[model samples]
Each structure stands twice: as structure tokens, then as C-alpha cells.
Target chain A: MTHPAEIKALVFDVFGTIVDWRSGVARGAAAFLDRYAPALDPYAFADAWRAEYSPSMEEIRSGRRRYVRLDVLHRENLVRTLDRYGIVDVPDADIDALNLAWHRLDPWPDAVAALHRLKRRFIIAPLSNGNIRLMVDVAKRAGLPWDAILGAEVVRAYKPSPQVYSDTVEILSVAPAELCLVAAHNGDLAAARRLGLSTAFVLRPTEHGPGQTTDLQADDAWDFDVKDLNELADRLGCPD
Target chain B: MTHPAEIKALVFDVFGTIVDWRSGVARGAAAFLDRYAPALDPYAFADAWRAEYSPSMEEIRSGRRRYVRLDVLHRENLVRTLDRYGIVDVPDADIDALNLAWHRLDPWPDAVAALHRLKRRFIIAPLSNGNIRLMVDVAKRAGLPWDAILGAEVVRAYKPSPQVYSDTVEILSVAPAELCLVAAHNGDLAAARRLGLSTAFVLRPTEHGPGQTTDLQADDAWDFDVKDLNELADRLGCPD
Candidate 1:
């Protein structure tokens, strides 16, 4: 797979690719569980917490409920995760603070360097499920030098939705061909590729924590595939 | 005036404030008119073209017409300006290309450095009447570093509508106090202040060209009244 010559902007999928959410959440949850409740299975709890992401968003998407930011959604889902495991000792303030752990999620080592390099040539932004405020908070915390932040909050539609990707490109006034979607998830890239967007796959082998299996390899013919964002930047000509 | 600690972000009024639109349009129009018809008074034509902005937008606001982007509004206004000036020699393509002069407007000298310095400490975006694509283009052309671009296109409500400014703060998830309205126009800043946003008045004495009369001096006790954006940054603790 080759880079499209016309590609001028690169939009990233943040969660698994740019930030190691699984391990970050796991570490944060493990630390909390260790101090608060040693009896809980931290790994299962981490998986369960992430498991709620889809259905929680679905509740809003299907119009079953009004729009809720990821922070609120995360708290709602956290209570359920705790209830299922019979662990209710955590206080509300602690839970509220912990929910913001999403903001402090650590990026992949290669993430910052790659983005910094890529920013030199392309208009770089994160087209993510996170809300604008959440993304901005994360960027400031992680020092991710994003040129702009474009998120589901702007369009009120989550990724894999053609509207989200198309609206993003339209907002930038760049042809779909000039924008590339870089992600660790195949489904995200596949959706973007279908909409005439170029695609790049950056492998995040440990994104799902210790037993993670999927997305460890680029299973599709994306425009570019690299070990990390720094390599992608090198390939894109971001100077050292 | 003391800096409002509550204001964490600053949104700008672009047209006459950050960019010298009158001169830009006049210069571009003169070149365009010269190429099309040698006889038209480019200065009067520029004023005539600009004179259509408010009424055209008002038509959309009153539901007398559909929501038309500033680009389309400029084109419509340009045609009428050409007709009034008896300029019959211009082709449609040239007119269409020249109507994009708004996109090519030059930034005021203080605009870039002030925005750049302020961006180091806070999130900076344009809360302008320009459509999304137009603002994005202007930022790229003028090298204005914005964390995100917010405009009337997002809310479909023009400035001073409260909905426009409030929707911007809501979308960015910043409280009204956490956002400052920085503009050369009192009407715009007044509306923002009414909505509980902090106000910063930067004087653009020549915004209306040499015939400018109003907004030559800051009238009210704005939170910060500075000569330029750099001065604003210096007051705000941007590094020297």
C-alpha cells in the first residue's frame, strides 16, 4: 500500500492507537482496586468497564435517552460494573475523580513524536469518540500537539458513522482523498476507506491489555502500516 | 482592568477585528475590477459589496430566505455591486474567483503573534460569522493557530444572537465565564458580555478604511482593552 499523493491532512483514531487506553485504564483501576478493594478482579473489571462503552453510546444513539458526554456515560457504566461484582465501597467523589482517568490516559511512546512530525506537513486532528472537552483535556495532559481537535461532540455522531468522517473532511474543506484516517482499529479505517478516505494502520499490540489478541496486526490493505506513529512520521517526512 | 481568572479561552471576531477586511476587499476588488472592466470605481464597489453583508444575513435570520453561507452571500452581493457600478465586462468565473477575496483577507499585525502567544496558555478559537470552511481557510492562510474553529455555521445563528455564542461555549464545554469575547466591534462584545462572557476589546481603528468612525476607542470597561493581541498576551502571562 502506498500513500496517496493528494493526501494533505491526517486524522487519527485516538483510543487504542494513539493512547493505550486498555493498559492505562487497567493500571489506574488496578491501583484503585488495590487500595480500595483487594478482593476485586481488576482485569475483569477493566474489560467490563470498556464493554459498557458501546451500549452506553447506543442508548443515546437509538434515542432511548438524551445526549450524554463520555464522562457521564463512564460514571453510569462504572456503577453497573461495580454492582455486577458486588463492590460498592467506592465513594462518589472518588468515582468522579477516577472517571477522569480517561483524561490522563498515557499515549503510545511513538504517538507524540509521530504526531509532531506529521504536523509539519499535514493538518493533524483527532477524529475521536471522546467529546471536545475530553480530547482537549487529554491533549493538554499528554502533550499531544494536535493542530485541531475534531470529535463526535461537533457532529453529534460517533465514528464508523459516515456522517462523522464525511462532516470532518467537509469541515476542513479538504477532499476525502486528501484526508487519511490513521487508527489501530481495522473497522475505523475500513469505514473511512469506504468513504473515499485514505487509511493508515498503526499497530497497538497491547491495546487490550495482557490477553489482547485482535488489532495486533494490520489485517487489511491500508495505505500505510507501521509499528508506531514515529515510523509513520518518518515515512511522511517529518524531519528529526 | 484586571484579568478575569474565569476566562480560560478567547474567541475572536475575525472580519474587521483580526483582519483588515476593508483594505483586503478593496485591493482584491481593484485587481479583479481592473482585469474585468477598467472603468469601475473599485473603492465604491468594495463598500457596496460589504454593505450587502448585514442585510443579506438579516434576510436569513428573519426566515425571509434560506440559510446561505457567507461565501454565497458575498457572491450574491458581488453581482449586485458589479451591476450597480455598471461593470458589464467581467466573466462569471472571474467573479466567482474574485468573490473569494474574503478568504484571502490579511490579518492585522498584532493578530498572529497575539493569538500564538495566547494559545500557549489557553484555548483560542474564532467565534466569527464566517462559515466553517472560510474560517478554516483563513486560519491556514494567515497561520492563526486555533485549537478548534467555531462559527455561525455550527449553530446556524449569526452573531449577537446569544444562541451563537452560548452554543460555542457549550460545544467546547467551557463555562461562559471561562470564555472571553475578543473583538474590535462593541456590538459583538456587548452581546457576549450580556451572555456572561468576559470581553476583550482590541482597537482596529481603520477597520472601515480611512472613513472609519466608531470602535476607534474602547467605550466600555472591558475586562482587557489592549493595543493588540500581543499586548493582551503580555498581560495574560505569555512568555516574553
Candidate 2:
């Protein structure tokens, strides 16, 4: 949807759309533990840890468990990933500090610039599943310029859940048609689209590293399709 | 409380602490239709509208009504205040537009500079009763540099409600003592302190009006008591 003055708010799906989390976590992990596990393939370790994310959140989304913040989930996943990799006896304090890697992820090359431009026009924020603290860290460290952080902790549910999108838009006081979700994930955009939230897809070709098989292109008729946030800014008429 | 690196989050009470809402609404109301209510005391109109605030929120805080966003409450108060002043037949749209004066408030002069300095040191956010949209507008327009907006709607209750304080601190994943609330009103700080949240009293002697009778001095031994945000920032070791 065009970002005319009336387009009240635009929410983003953060992980792959705004930041390259895989590379970011890999780098952070390597920095934290290259000496402890010299044979560790950092990128593979990043994938292994991330693999735990969905199932843990699914437990909550399915009502089998109550809501827990992403920071807790990330640390839990971290411990399990370390065990599988035979990295043992790491100090709890060290583990806790390393878990903040999620908070320090690097935004996409186009993200900060595009978001700054968009901020001048739209009430832009993240509707990611990351908890409020997580979103706040990522925005501060990456210069995201979000007006507020909204997601899992606020709504007590994970993404793709209808309430995650619906309740978030309600908090921003924007109708579904006036709220847009820009993401690299079709599943997320499709969920948002089902609830009448406008959608934009940005290609993150290497999000899962070179052999990435999913979300390489806009597979559905999203409201807008772009290669990156810069293109999104252009489409939304944000000037250079 | 000292704002060392350990002070994880500093949540602000926005209305009088950060912004001047009374003069703001008065200006907007006068501009919206000065001819219709030429004899209207703009400041009194502001006070009349604000007088309904606590009683309305008290309904929710007392569990007699469900939580409502501050924007809705403000609009409701505005309509009632207008009727009391003998203004009639104003369209709903104009009232709605004028009610947004809360979103356009001018920050206390020290707020922006001090907050910018404080932002570099702490995770600063507003823990006001304003809804996400209203906080977003106020922060965006006033350049308050908040890391996130955490408040009433997010907690699903208005302030002085223990949940409002407890839940907001939980969102930041900080211990109660690690989160400091800086507000102009002694009562707000007192409520925060009751729940083990650290408190700072920034004196806004004129928050209610020139002859404001309450909260003129720190009534309790708050963790930190100062005359303004600049002094608060200074005591916290944020450099000029």
C-alpha cells in the first residue's frame, strides 16, 4: 500500500526482513566461544540454535505452555544447542551474556536508511514475535527508529497467530487496511493478509545462507513486492 | 537511584514529566474554534478536560469498567467539558481532532536534551498511561528519543494500578529496583516506590497550573529527587 499520510502505521517482521540474524548470531557466537570450540562451524551452530525457536514458541501458541519471553527461550535453546555440540561446563554468566546476541543483530544494509526515511512519513514499528526487550535492543543497537515495540510479550502470543497481528494493529489504533506488514516470510505476510493487513515482501535471498530454499521471492500477490527496504521506500514515495 | 550501567531501564511518566499537556490542549482547542467560545478560558478548558481523567481511569482501576485507551478517555472528557462550558453542536470530527492535542504536547525544555544524553546510558522509555498511538505521536513529534513505549494499554490497565507498574517492568526483564520511574508528581513516584521500583521526583511545580497546590516538593524520601530532567540526568552521571 502506498504510504500516504493516512496510512496510520506500518509494522515489520524483523528477523530476516530487517536484520541478517543468521550471520549476526554466528559472528557473535564465534566471538564468544572460538577458543572453547575451535572445530565449531559457527553458521551451522546458528542454524541449530534457531531450529529450536519455532517448536518452543509452538508450545505456547498451541496452549501447551504459557507465554515466556524470547530471551528466556533463546537461552534455553542456547543451552540445548551447546549440549548437542559437546560444549559443556560453560559458566552461567557467560551463557547469559552470549544470549544477548539476538539483541545485537545487524540490520540489513538498506534497513536503517529506509526506516529513517519511512519514519518521517509513517508511524513505523516492529510487530515481530521477539519480546519487547529484544525488539528494543535490536532497534537501539541497529538504529531502527521504531516508534514503539509491539509483539509476543505485549499480546502474549507468537506470530502467525491472528491476535499477534490483529491485537497489534488495534494497539496502534489503525484498521487492518491501514496497517501494513512488511516481511521476507510469506507465511507471515499471508497471515497478515488473511486479516486484511496490507503486505509487502522483500527478498532475503541469503537469509538461510547460500542454499536458502524458502522466501526467495514474493510467491503470493502481496500488496507490494520489493527487493529491499530501499525499494520499499521508493515504492512508498520516500525521497532520497 | 544512581543510573550506573546497572540501571537497565528508566521509565518516564510522560504527561507533566516530559510534556506540557495543559497549555498544549488549550492552544489546540482555541485554534480549533476560538470564535465559537471566545470567552473560553483556554487553561480552564484544559483543566476541565483533565479533571475527568482520574475519575474515568479510577473506574477501570477499581474494576468497575474495562480498560480503555487514554485517547478515548480524553475524547470523552473533552466532550463533557465542552458541554459544561455551554459549547454545543460541534461536529464529532472537530472534537476528535482537538482531542489529539495530547499527541502534540511540547516537551519540557530539559526533556529532549537530557533524554538524549540519558538514552546513551540507559534504556529509556515512557511508562505513561497514554496508549501506544498517543505515545508514538508525542515521542515522534517532540523528539523524546524513547527506546520503547511501555504504558497503560500495553499493561491493559491505567497507572497507580500495581499491574501497570509491575507488568511494565517485567516487559523490560529487569528487577524492580533496576527500573527507575522519573515523574513530576510525588504520588506517581510514591506508587512506584511502593512496589520496589526505584523512583525519582522531578519537580514540575506548574503541572496543574501556576497555583498548583500539590506535589510542589518531594513529600517522600524518593530514591532520587531533582528539580527537572536535566538535574536528574546530571545526578545520574549523564554528561552535558
Candidate 3:
């Protein structure tokens, strides 16, 4: 195992690792559906909308489409999801607000407190696919105490891309090995580890809802494995 | 005057406006000089180093050199300043720390508290030439609570450049008019105003020392003229 002493910064995967986006989006979708398409199942609607996230990013990742902020992608996905659900005629204003639901995600129960503790010992920021505005809005609303906003927007590329991790390391002025990427997603950690960044696998078994099968456990021999951010903080010897 | 009510984000010029860099740099230089070059005047050393800032940036802005982070520029400037002061043979480590003096700058007396107040109402960030790492370090050390670090590094250009303000506006996802650029420098505000952003002129008469002549007061008809950040917050209707 790599020594934790070298880790000076901890960049998190935000969507599900730090925030309970599944539940947050479900709640937000429920409110929108109630106001627009009351008969729809908000949970299914949220899952469908979220299911489009990766594929949308894939287009940019594969260079098939130009890069746009996650907010823009989320808006496009929202429109497509609405059509898929056979719900139309939603006002542009309401649709805009619904798109911003990604910005209002709630933290997992232990995320905020743990982040505050970790911030005392490490530079903590999101290294997710979320754009600067979306991350800033989420940080402000969810009380995420980020030292700086770092992510896809800053690098102009989505996560799992070498550019994202490399750019974050360059921005932080830290060696890749001196930075740790914390995530509940195996793919994120895998990509980070391949780029020589330290990796911490955070278990968020219910991230994709109760039946979530993938990333329920650390797939690789990550540098650290912890149940939540708080445990990760404790293992890193952060002061309360 | 433009209405302050439309402003959604408040992007600041950090060095002379939020933090008293002159005093902070002088203090940091004194400590370093005391250990290495005891006979040197730290205040003069600080001024000499700062004097190189604009010219170094101009090189990048004019495309005489490719973009480099402010930290890198500061390091190069530090070595030249030390040589000019006849203080050579300093270890690379000490020189590196001295270059980071910019990151340890102390905020103006009312800056932090006023920022907290303004933060309750607006998205406050440092839109300075300082790179993300420098800004993050300064924010952490000085307790300046910023919503995001948006500046020269993020845009890969120095201030007074259209890319800096335009990219910042794009990142904040706010219309140019909906963002306010707050600074103690007339040139900065003038550049921002030309980009259609609301401008707030802050007074920092002693920024370049007691004899400081420029930017002593508002030069143009700014949208808001305030004595300090506290007054700026009050004029913007931020909570006490």
C-alpha cells in the first residue's frame, strides 16, 4: 500500500461519492413531475435522466461532439428524457430549473462533516465531471467547503480522461502521486490510479439505489478503502 | 449607474483590493532576508519584486511567451529580484518559499468579515491573476471564503484582457451585466466595464504604501463607490 503521508490534496468524485444524487434527483424530479406530469414515476424518471449522463459524455470523450458544460448536457438530456417519458409541453423555465436539479444535490449523510475535517489536513475539491458553475452552485447549496473548484470544466474534458487528472495535478501544482482521488466509482479510481494518482475507494453501495451491483466494493487493491468520507478522514489522520 | 440589484456574482481583484499584499510580502521578505541577507531592506525587496509583476504578465499577454501559472512567474521574478538586491546563492528551497509569499498575503482589515457578509448575498470569488493554487493557498491561509477560484490561470490570460472577464462570465454562467467586478484599481474596473460587467471601485490608498498615488479614489463613474469591502457589502445590501 502507498503511504498516505504523500497525499496533500484529495479530489472527490461528486455525483454519487460525495452527494446522494440518486435520492436528490428523485426528489427534484418528483417535484417537477408533480407540477408538470403528475402521473409519472419520479424515481424512474430520475434514473432515466441519469442513465443518459455517461452516454452524453461519451460523445465528447470520443470526440464525436464538442465539449459543453455539464449543465448544457444535463439540459439536453432532460429534454430527451422528457420525450422518452412521453411528457411534453414543459415550459422552458421549468425545464431549466429541472436541469439545475443536478446542482442542488444533497450530500450523503457524512460527506460535508468529513470534508470539513479533511480540509484541515488536505486540499479538498471536486474532480468530477460537473462544470465550474454547477459545482459552485452545489458547493454553495450543499455546504461543500472546497478549497477551489477543479473538474471537467476547468480542464474542458470529462472525468476518466487523462487530461482531467493531469490538469488537476497541474492546477494544484502537485505531483500526481501526491494527490489522491477519492470516489465511490471504481472506474474513477481505476483511471486515477493508472495516471499515478493515489486512489481511495469509498463504498457507496446504494449510490445507484439499493440494487446497485457495481462499485459496491473496491474492485482494485486501492490505496485505501473506507465506508464513507468520515472514515477516510480518520484514516488520513485529520483532526476533528 | 448600473443597478447593483442585477449582480449575481462578485468577482474580486485580490492583491491590493482584498489582501494588503505590500505589507504581507514585505513581512514575508523580511523573515527570509533576516535568515539570508540580513542587511537588505525587505520592504524595498518586496516592492522591487512586485514591480516585475505587470511586465512579466505583459510578456504572456503579448504572446512573447506561452502561458505559465502566476506561481511560476513569481518564482522567476523572485530570483531576478534577489539577484538585483545582490542576495545570490540562496538555496532553491528557500527561494521557492519566498516565491510563495504571495500565497500567504494577509487580507485587508475588513476584507474577510465583509466577504462573509457579501457571500451571503452573492457568489464571491477571486478573479485575480494569481493561479488556482496560489488563490487556494491565499484563501485557506487568509480565511478568504470564495465561492470559486476564477482568474488568469483558468482563462490562461492576464487581467485587462478580454478573455479573463469573458471566460469568467462564461464560467459563472451569468450575463456580463449580472456579474460585478470589484477592485481598488481603476484600470481593472475600466477593462471590466468595457466588457459590460458592473463595476465597483474600492478605495485602497495605502496599497502601494503611504505615498501611493494611483487608485486613491474612483477615476471613472463606477456603478458603486465604496470606502472598503464593508461599505461595499452595505451598499450591495448584504447582511451584516
RMSD of each: 2.8, 1.8, 1.4
**Reference-based lDDT, residue A118, model 3:** 96
Chain A TM-score vs. truth, each candidate: 0.93, 0.96, 0.97
Model 2, chain B only, scores a TM-score of 0.96
- lDDT tens digits, residue span A160-186, model 3: 889899889989989999999999999
Task: Please report how far candidate 2 places residue A1 from its true position, in Å.
Answer: 6.5
Best by DockQ: 2
Q: Write the per-residue lDDT of candidate 1 for residues B1-240, one digit (tens) a residue.
A: 335566688899999878888878888888787776677777667788999999888887777877666887888888887787777777889988888888888899878887878877898888888987777667778888887777777677788788888887887777887888899998898899888888999988888878889998878998889888888888788885
Q: Candidate 2 on B1-240: residue-level lDDT in tens?
A: 544555778999999999998889888888765766887788888898899999989999999989888998899888888888888999888888898888899998889999999998789999999998899998899988989889898889988989989998788888998999999888888888888898989998888889899888999888888988989888888888
lDDT, model 2, position A78: 96
Error of 2 at B147 (Å): 0.5
lDDT of 3 by residue, B142-199 (tens): 8888988999988889999889999899999999999999999999999999999999
Q: Candidates sorted by TM-score, descending order?
A: 3, 2, 1
Better of 1 and 3 by TM-score: 3
**lDDT by residue (tens digit), candidate 2, A64-142:** 9888988999999999989988899999988998898899999989999999988888888888889999999888888
Question: Per-residue lDDT for B31 in model 3?
Answer: 86
The CAPRI class of candidate 3 is medium
In candidate 1, stretches whose alpha carbon ends up further than 4 angstroms from where it belongs are A1-3, A26-35, A38-45, A87-92, A234-240, B1-3, B41-43, B64-68, B88-93
lDDT at B96 for candidate 1? Answer: 80
lDDT for each candidate structure: 0.82, 0.88, 0.91
Cα deviation of B186 in candidate 3 (Å)?
A: 0.4
